[model samples]
Target: MKKKRILSLCMGLFFSTLLYSQMVGIKTNVVMDALRIINVGAEIGLSKKMTLDLYANYNPWEYKELQMMKMLALQPELRYWFCDRFNGHFVGAHIHGGVYQAAGIDMPFGIWPDLKDHRFKGHFYGMGVSYGYQWILSKRWNLEGNIGFGYARVKYEQFECKTCGDKVGEGHKNYVGPTKAALSLIYVF
Candidate 1:
């Protein structure tokens, strides 16, 4: 009877810990200058070693001749932390989808030269696996770096210019390369 009670107490503690560890965070990738990129997310601890995060990125800016980046994207990921939740090394599988419009914008990593010297107004979606490391900066702050590889199916139409909005060509592309890349400054709570 005492052993049963102990086991029950332990299980109850585990469940309560998971419940209390639920966190909400907001982050931004400061590298992309043109689009004011911000991602908001909620993290739910599934186990001591696993978490589920859902986040979305929105850029509500219009494309001028110089402002070259704009997109709206949603990303949901299931991550397995090697040591613990919200800390250390993590491996994740993420699926992301979004719509974008830009001209002469260069995507970083291996996904570069995307629409070089040209403009495209279209939509893209993809899925990928990522490896990331999160560093605890303070009690409520974390900095994370992540890199991912996958494929994006992009359907786009070429424009003669961004501001003028004159259509020059139209087609779709299946891009198989780096899909997710971010150096994130995170505010964890």
Candidate 2:
């Protein structure tokens, strides 16, 4: 959150010093997370060639008590206008990463072993980059199409239990995998 604020401030200062074309908008996507996510977010253009964005998502996973995961992501990117109408565009490879957590589940470990008195928790951190294109419909309304790839590392730890058997025993399981691809839209304000 603080990082986003600082990036916004820096962009504001940089753009304020020059007369550059800029706009803001909001975006929504239904196929963000394996078709289990609906995302609504906002974006800002610092110039005709640069953009800064911050957004959040509600992801639904049906395996635990916290069935929905919420995330906050901040991205600062550079773009090149391929045309004058904001129609054809190219966005450079950008770095976007943030914090998020999964909900509902009491155990992070795989299918509970044969333990009857043990439980666990699974938490994670992720970072990645994406490449894509943007098509501006107007000053404030634009449709963006991009493919984003990233990685997420999950921390799984065991809890207290006596009958935990070999299934729910104590210990840690760390999972690192590709975060997934993002096909989303954006509304610049």
Candidate 3:
């Protein structure tokens, strides 16, 4: 019910914005010192100074011994361009809503009776804000970069087995710290 409504609303917004002539772009980035993050993002310009962006990311790490931790996220954002050109540069702000998954945690309240190989899954809601600059490389291409901070709250779920089985109950809650760093990219129309 609620998930359907959310998906429908996102689809509606995505299609409704396609009526304009805008620049489209894709970006990729890797995060350092952490669990090795891989990020991909897409953007559609609403105007010269405003646009919408959708993004996703993944992080892979090891939990304790018998488990692995993988985190995935999807984010949609509204960006406001602050400067059109400065030394052949562009600047903007990105406000984002993020959804995420965290895997391989302990089952809450020992939901599983045996507790042999039960796996845990977590869902999160998050937000991010970033300021960035793009340097023009050609007529329709540019090099872009940004630094940002983000936070997330997660609720976990319990599964009896690694692959298939029964789910016990709602999981646990986690508060994630902010992310601060840079993402560089090549933009195109």
TM-score of each: 0.73, 0.52, 0.58
Off by over 4 Å in 3: 1-19, 30-39, 58-67, 85-119, 158-171, 174-176, 179-182
The candidate maximizing lDDT is: 1
> Of the candidates shown, which would achieve the greatest TM-score relative to the real structure?
1
lDDT to native, each model? 0.73, 0.49, 0.58
Return model 1's CA RMSD, one decimal: 11.3
Q: Decide which is better by lDDT, 1 or 2.
A: 1
TM-score of 3: 0.58
Per-residue lDDT, model 1, residue 9, is 63
Backbone clashes for every candidate come to 0, 15, 2
Preferred candidate (TM-score higher): 1 or 3: 1
Tens digit of lDDT per residue, candidate 3, span 1-189? Answer: 765676577666655665453667765654432446667666777677776766666666555655555665566667677764311333343333334333445645654333346666656675667666777777766666666666656566776665567888775554444443555465565
Candidate 2 per-residue lDDT over residues 1-189, each given as its tens digit: 775785577556545533443665556654664555645554556566555544455444434432434444444444454553234655444444444433333344653342233444444455555555667667656666655555555455444433132434334333343343444555453
Off by over 4 Å in 1: 1-21, 32-35, 62-67, 106-117
- TM-score sort, best first: 1, 3, 2
